[model samples]
Target: MTRMTRLTKWLLLMAAITLEVSATLSLRAALNHPALYVVVAIGYIGAFTALSFVLRAGMGVGVAYGIWSACGVALIAVLASFVFGDALTARMVMGIALVIVGVLCIELGSQAAHTRQTREGEATP
Candidate 1:
């Protein structure tokens, strides 16, 4: 990819991740009222829009979503425990770690597929 495309992808990825974080935070806040589907819908739509931009910039959907969700979950759990005084147990921590591992595996798998495709295309005569 061109440098500009790479930069744009990175920017879109950041935007996607930021929207996810915002959505999670808002949903957490809206839970008490439970009449905030509009707010939740807005958040979800923003997140999906940003994600589409990122995917359009060449990110694989599974890889992008896996990484985005892993990071979001970790951050949400941490903030939930600290900001909302939600329980933070060893089981939860382990679950978060497993999610991180899964994300990494998705990234690796995407990279492998991308590299294989690149090689195959190059070999076409």
Candidate 2:
């Protein structure tokens, strides 16, 4: 693919991540305030839509979802802590760091697997 195409795909992937993050926050809000259920539902629906576009841009579902969810979870944890005044101790920060590291490892592994598969596919042809 051309550089522009690759960039576009990446942008879409980021959009997907953004949507998922928004949906998570909205869902939390809706849960607390039943009247916001419709807004939350819409946010989630938009999130899935963005995710679908990202997949269409050629990202594997596992890889995409892993990155998306990890980011969303991390952001939501921090946001929730701030919004709810939940304890955010040093240990909690350490745990979040670990979560990020684990997710990065998963992304790296998945990327390696994807590159291998692409090489194999090329060789087969």
Candidate 3:
């Protein structure tokens, strides 16, 4: 199978994150409306499906999962603040920033390691 482009991988990750966040939010809303449980079910299922595609696209599982969880947490917190009047303090923002930075470091480190492995493989007889 053809490898997915970098943009496609990232886009799939983003879709996964969005679906997860929406599902979580729907869960919260379902407490009141109850009918939104349908959305919660659909969203969670779709999110996992998208994540599977991301993995099949050749992105490392650690990087894909880290970014997916980080973005999902951040988006849920921020969106919930607006949608449900949940508190979003400065400390929470800082924590989200740290999570994002940590994921970025993992991705960069993974890329560097892959490059080194490729070079070493090429150098071997």
> How far is each candidate from the true structure, as Cα RMSD in Å?
2.4, 2.5, 1.8
* C-alpha RMSD of candidate 1: 2.4
User: What's the residue-level lDDT of 59 in candidate 3?
Assistant: 88
Candidate 2 per-residue lDDT, tens place, 3-104, comes to 876677668767776777776776777777887777667777777887788788787788778877877778777887888676788987887898799878
lDDT of 3: 0.92
lDDT string for model 3 (6-86, tens) is 789989999999899999999999999999999999999999999999999888898899889988898899999999999
Q: After superposing candidate 1 on the true structure, give the runs of residues whose Cα lies further than 4 Å from its correct spot.
A: 31-42
Model 1 lDDT-worst window of ten = 33-42
lDDT per model, in order?
0.82, 0.78, 0.92
Q: Is candidate 1 or candidate 3 better by TM-score?
A: 3
Name the regions of candidate 2 deviating beyond 4 angstroms: 31-35, 121-125
Pairs clashing within candidate 3: none
Pick by lDDT: 1 or 3, better one:
3
Q: What does candidate 2 score on TM?
A: 0.77
Task: Compose the digit string of candidate 1's lDDT tens values, residues 3-113.
Answer: 999788768777777777777777877888676656777877887898898898888777788787888888789788988899999999999999888988887888799
- What would you estimate as the lDDT of candidate 2? 0.78
